[model samples]
Target chain A: MKVLEAETYQAGEVHRFEAAGQEFVYLAPAGGIFGISAAAAAVLETMGAAGRRMDELRAEMRAAGFSAGDVEEALEELIEARVLERPRTLPPPRQKMPERFPLQSLVMNLTNQCNLSCKYCYEYGEDKVATPDGKPKFMDWETAKASVDFFLQDSAGRERLHITFFGGETLMNFPLLKKVVDYAEAAAGAQGRAVDFSLTTNATLLTPAIIGFLADKRIGVTVSIDGPPDMNKLRVFANGRPSYDVIAPKIRELLARHRTRPVGARVTLTAEVTDCIRIFRHLTEDLGFQEVGFAPVTSSQKNLVTIGSGKMDSILEQFCALADEYLAAALENRQHAFSNVTDTIAELHEGVNKSHPCGAALGLVGVGPSGDIAPCHRFVDSDTHKLGNVFTGIDRSKQADFLERGHIDAKYDCHTCWARPLCAGGCHHEAYVRYGDTGHPNLHYCDWIRTWTDKCLRVYGAIAAQNPGFLEHFERRKAS
Target chain B: MKHLRAVNRKAVRVAGEIDAAAADVHALQEGAPPQPKPVPHYPVGCTIVFSPGWEVDSSGGTAGLCQPAERDLYDCYATCFWPAQVPDHLNNYPDWTKKCASATKDWREIDLVFP
Candidate 1:
């Protein structure tokens, strides 16, 4: 906490806005937006444009007609909050990762072949084309086996581990999934470790047998469905017919059969659909999913149907509406049907502050259909971002490069952004897709994120105050 | 504006690590899930393997890390990767286990102290 000096001081990025007839300065670095007298807002506005000496600032404040006491108190408050701080020179960068890295998760891209061609699909969601590296569409069982072995061995010291089967559709390669499950179980048993299995599927290809198998093996499944038929216009069969009708019954069947573990519904929100509450209702209330989450379409490609600035406010408003519903349900000791609300609530319930948006290059690596390792599932098809191959092991330099790019300091704007800790430079892959540079943070959604987070914070405060017992449900949810 | 309170910040951390301990004791005594041992915070699906080979107490007052030797067959005394209590994310998160990938070490910490 640098104290503002009377001799000299620098103002960080302080966003000044007038909301609800009150003057406010949102100090981004401090994660505080304070309502101050209009005079104080004027002071911050002037000072924030450039660094200034204290006496010069006072003179400006006085000329602007602010009283000595108000100006003094305003400066005191700003300095106390670390909004105004001493300027400093940059320090040399240090190593961003450990020399001996710990491997905790292996995301296996079972195959690149998919039956459904969703418009928002990042992996050339355009066509059944070869991978960006021009590799074959399917992963060989041998490569998959080796990758599993590597994670179990490399992450041996870890008491528990997870293997996520990702792909064009994991069920597209059911045989490999089964074989890997058996092999992983045997391997974990030998290592005295526990391995949990999860998969993200489109639900177009799931049959009774596959659902039974997943339930039998206790593999958690997350079905990708936007909403009712009209909401999922972008998701279609390879032949270009809407897939909601075809996948809906399959999803219901999956929910009915996959009894061993909870089945979550994952909805991808594109520019076409910002009706969050409606989609959430259909997924959880209408469809009976245990939980449901939403991930906005991330590709910045011109051809993709990505969410734009126009829809973010409506999306945020709808999310807050659902959050209110989540609060109502939680206070009554009932589980909310909305996964997004529940997830944010859980984080707030637990006070989770993340520095990175996710565990991409750290312990979690996404193995492509071939033997290649990418930063995460999103980067699996991106050749440039490929960190290494499973058979060859991680290319420390490339992996380290991607990891370093994600370091908060490496991002120019993120260091000063109040949301840096949780946004973690936004999604690394999103940055790569948008700017063609992995180090950049996607500023496109920064406003939406900050606004959404603010809503979550408010929701947390309400639930914590009204229903303390609702938090106990965390234990039950964790157990369930 | 009121600042964030410390207690509210760390509420229900590791499901109150103590409550979990009590539940574990209750389960051993009642041979049922009397109270659930709080959920450990190693993300969902990850398990913690505690250190083994503990010296047990022959007497059975309470079977714990070193409580009752007779009841101490499986209870982990030393630390396990999966701590029973979740770290208080607000106050003491970014524990030794690992930092969330998004959290980078701020470079400013390396600068020399100035008067």
Candidate 2:
């Protein structure tokens, strides 16, 4: 480990770049972006190299059209903004885990059974723990009601709540899902609150009736399809037959019918299915998905389809290629289908400093078909990570322990990394699958995440510089 | 200040010696002017009000508002209540204030959102 020496006025850790003829600085400490004036830029330059005394920096700022008082004010502002740094007078404080955090959303795992047995399916893969021997294969209406009530009660004073349906194939339990929607709507309505419904499906079981119901209820749908038939080699049926042909027409009907919320496509990128650009094209252009998101498959090291280091590098390159397309579309005030870039940019724009990997176990939790609660969808069937059962309340002690262990402060490897605010040590389930510990950092993707973050930073800088109005429009769309 | 139209009547004192009864020092109250017609070309669902300053508080005064305006940003964004200026973080930008621990100390990190 490298030691930092004492400094009077050191420059803060920042990524500086010029885009669209405007200079920008991404402040590492605060995750803030600032467009410096010429005077502030000069002060940054004068102190950029090494720490300098107040008198010394003031002398230079005086020459740059700043009065003595003005220079002092400017320096203080910079220090406050974390654009300039001073040695901490006190030791850094540890972040405390919040108690009594309310839940905002729940992921309901509809079933442990699936029609398609994707080669890298995490639910049934090597890493998966066998479903509890007596657990039901599909979630029943009673459990679904209990989960909805649990979610609403846990959310307490919340004006709105969200529930996402998940499963080996969410559509496998469509009848129950329909009942839960109506029940949840009436329940929330009685309480003078609103509830939003969304689901992730393989689309193989979607019928005209299902599509019409989804459209009428305005339920958001996310289809899990890799890409065109050629790219979806691993996403096959139980009998080892391809599934693209079956799902494509169904997805088309769903997209055509579902008009309230844009239907998104979630692509699982495996070692064999590494063609991100082609997959993105087929999903967004050919199949007409409003947004397409790609996630590298999560699996144990022994899983053959698990992406190794070399393949991960290639995936990063493909992600960057798609990001460039996103950038081009953004510059012209157009929407792009690359949800990864859009999601990251949104986080960057919001200056998200996550203590945990995500909202899992914090604002969100997952319920299995048997009413057992887990941290998230990925942990639904896993017997190891159950937080509690929906009938009983979430176990506070267990949840606290999981959060404390997963906190950024507990992740030693992430202490010095500037991207920790955005990444927060990567996905918890991925860490658990790869390292046998939920608290372990996903070291394999550190470089990839850092590179991808930098690319997004530049994309944000370019947009803030050239077409800032687009950012406003984007924010409005997101809010709406 | 030059472009802004003064909304309320107030006394303006010149910081210099002046004649007690000087022409510019009169305390006369002027008659109110007729209200102008609303702009016809303005789009519907517009929330932008042509007020004299940034915003007025519930009491119809600026004193009740948070100082420096940024202090109230997180409050407004968090609840998405009365989001006339900042982006609402409740339903829309739920993660907007995730990085902002204390708005007073981290005001610079607050994002600028427009209607």
Q: How far off is residue A207 in model 2, in Å?
A: 0.7
Q: Which ten residues in a row have the lowest lDDT in candidate 1 chain A?
A: A24-33
Task: Give Cα distance to truth, residue A48, candidate 1, Å.
Answer: 12
| Local error of candidate 2 at residue B65 (angstroms) | 24
Candidate 1 overall Cα lDDT vs. reference? 0.68
Candidate 2 lDDT over A142-205, as tens digits, reads: 8999999999999988888888889978888888898999999999999999899999998999
Model 1 ranges off by over 4 Å: A1-96, A125-134, A349-355, A472-480, B1-4, B7-115
Candidate RMSDs in order: 16.3, 15.7
Candidate 2 local lDDT, B27-101, one digit each (tens):
111111122234211111112221112344332233344453343444465654564566666566676666768
lDDT of 2 at A353: 67
What TM-score would each prediction reach against the true structure?
0.68, 0.76
lDDT of each: 0.68, 0.75
| Cα lDDT of model 1 by residue, A1-480, tens digit | 222345676665554444334454444443343445665566677686567888888888889888877777667556555456556676435434467667778899899888987887777744212255578688888898889877776685787788999997888899999999999988898878888899999998889998889999999898888998889998988788999888889988888778898799888888888788889889887888988888888766465476766776788888888877887787788877677777765654544445457888888999887778888887786667778787788888887777777777677776666656467778777787788777788888887887776666565555655676777766565544
Number of residue pairs clashing in candidate 2, backbone atoms closer than 3 angstroms, sequence gap of 3 or more or interchain:
0
lDDT: which candidate is best? 2
The alpha-carbon lDDT assigned to residue A430 of candidate 1 equals 74
